[model samples]
Target: MKPLVWIVALAVLSYSTISGMVGHDHHVLIIAGATDGYLSPCGCVKPMSGGLRRRVTAIKQLSVPNMTTVIETGGFVKDSGRQDQMKAEAIAETMKLVKVAAINYGLEEARLGAGMAASLDRLSGEALVATGLGGGAIPVKKFKVSGPFLIGGIDPRIEQIGAALGSKLEPIDESVRALTDEAKESKLVPVLMTRGDLESAEAIAKKHPSLRLIVCSVKSSPYDAPRRVGDTLIVTPGEHAKYVVRIEWDGQAFTAYRFFDLGPEYADDKQAQEVYTAYLARVTSEDLLSMVPRSETDVFAGSAACAPCHAAEQRVWKASAHSKALATLEKEGHDRDPDCTGCHVVGLRSVNGFRSRAITPNLTDVGCESCHGPSKLHAMNPTKHKLAKVGKESCMPCHNTEHSPTFDFDAYWAKIKH
Candidate 1:
């Protein structure tokens, strides 16, 4: 009887595994609004969540045996310029590798301008599903993810102060209605993707109850399970590449939906790591950041110039890690790198700030100017350039959560205080 029971249990377990494999023969990953850049896990600080390497690794793991298609819902990278352009390129290439079925061009991509978007579209090949950029205004994109599975993106029009960074704003209601109608004609399971707030998403659902799944983009929040809204389901995988959301289809309804957290536990994919490392190398090599001309008003005054006025503070600064910020980068051979040099040195990106160790040796390191703002004027009139506030707002430029996750203003201030 005991032997029979053991055999029955084994059979049940085997059957379960087989059933799972069969059910998940075709898998689709919905990544929404990460605001993840190409060379991320920014700052390389420990306990970091996601990066390109981990994202690639997770995609590779999911692609085994099962047919996988990754649909990215934009907000690709935050911030702009040459570095952002490079990061977009990286995202396009990685999408090619992981076979990204579609991309809902988020605001970040739009900000790259139309010329760059067309270039990336050419690069993505067959992977870039649909032109999320519709006639005049556009929602992200709505594309076919093989079989009858379809994914669509919904993004608000950006026409406020910095409208040039965005495309024309199409009425959301009309766009969603049209896309859903198109998908329904082909008998496709249209899934809506968004990088907006919950209120906007709910409004869309209210208007178009036909959309059963809505993948959302969030900033600095934990992954939320699918929440039912009328007949539609809204879910977010959180920001950054911190998590990848997977949903399995049984040819009817979604059988399983789970998020794979990409943390330090997983080993990095060598190729993706090379991509990120190469980006780091390029930023350092090209010295692109140095091109940003500093203003005349914000001039750098050497840290030494301020030493006499605040002797005790200078002493504390000299003793603190901020004192040798450049040397730390130098040890890693990134001292000359713009990304490194900018934060490590005083006024590196400002008026008359550190240019290089050779050009502005006096300005190198997190000098008093870094915290107190550029002070060429202060040297002439010490009382005029007094800081208004020296709190979180002041330090976060470099000491942000991306750079120092463990940072606490009170505790850190205590250590470096005069």
Candidate 2:
């Protein structure tokens, strides 16, 4: 009887020891990301909704105890210019400050043509990529929050790009099976991070229901709620840094999934602002706005050029925000910034439009020519001038939803209608 009691007591003690080794009281895994190059919110609209600085404040508040693992998936620069490169680098630095564990490359990052991706990876401390294909660690982190293992994958659609970045390609089902076996044997949790779509994730999930969670990168639409595919939960952080998935684990499995909406409620992190300002400074240094010779298509005949011909329209323009757009950038010290100035200036980077302050000084600010089309040929001879028509498509180049979210052609046109 005594021997049997001792054996039962020892078994109970062993169970307790194993559980302690595998679990913690409060293990939180912050599945954060920037799927596309929406590092900052579009300032075209007031009371801007999302920005990395505000997101930083939210992340800081959530990670109070330093018991969190942050991961950034793929995102790309809208413009591949030197200034944009600086912006991307600043984004990476900001991630580092929050102690992000890894970043997986997606189609956008791959589209950077390998060389640029490599440069970005280097500038980002190589922490930007966590590839298992090119001989990376099986489990990207050793944190016991969601067990001690993790796996990352790139989209097959960008396989060539992944290959260029040195990540090998393999069948998802096979990889999942083999990886899961390996993780199980090693006593590690298996989490799958992919740049693939929902269908691909579902297929993988059906075969490997044991996976802790599947983090999918989305573009067109973000998941409004978590969906269960097989025994795994497929989740994504909505686009544009609008929301971050805050997951809590009991060291066994996720206990709660809290997705916080980063809105006007959150304040900006001053430190992140410094990094962003530094990036803007780099843009100023590149001199991307240096004067260039205007081409034959039609030069930017500043709004003033049109004022002499159309006094009513000129009055409407001057009183409108479009006329003072460049001034606004000047107020923020971004007057010379290639990213902001392009949209604000008349044909700043358009076809044979405004080139620079040195040569096309008059082209500064959004002008009649910006929407009415380049009028160098027409301006010199108005009777000969002819515009086929004006349409919403023409205005969308700068007034699209991402930047000018509240833009309504009817309302905006009414404001500037001559």
- Give the Cα error of residue 207 in candidate 1, in Å: 2.8
Report lDDT per candidate. 0.67, 0.66
Candidate 2 residues 1-418, lDDT tens each?
6743543454345334433332445566666675355666656766555678877887776663545677666564554556556666777777777876666655566555556656666655555543434344221221122225465544555466555555555555655676677678777667777777777888778878888787886763356567787568888876667667766556576655656666666688998888878876776777666543334565656667777778888888889988888788888767776557778888765556665666777787887877887876677887897766887877899998767888999998888787
Off by over 4 Å in 1: 1-26, 30-33, 36-38, 129-142, 158-170, 297-319, 330-340, 368-402, 408-410
Per-residue CA lDDT of model 1 for 167-231, tens digit only, reads 45556676677668877897877777776777677777888888877776666554446667786
Ten contiguous residues minimizing lDDT sum, candidate 1: 131-140
Structure candidate 1, residue pairs in collision:
34-240, 132-140, 132-141
Using all chains and alpha carbons, the TM-scores for the candidates as numbered come to: 0.77, 0.81
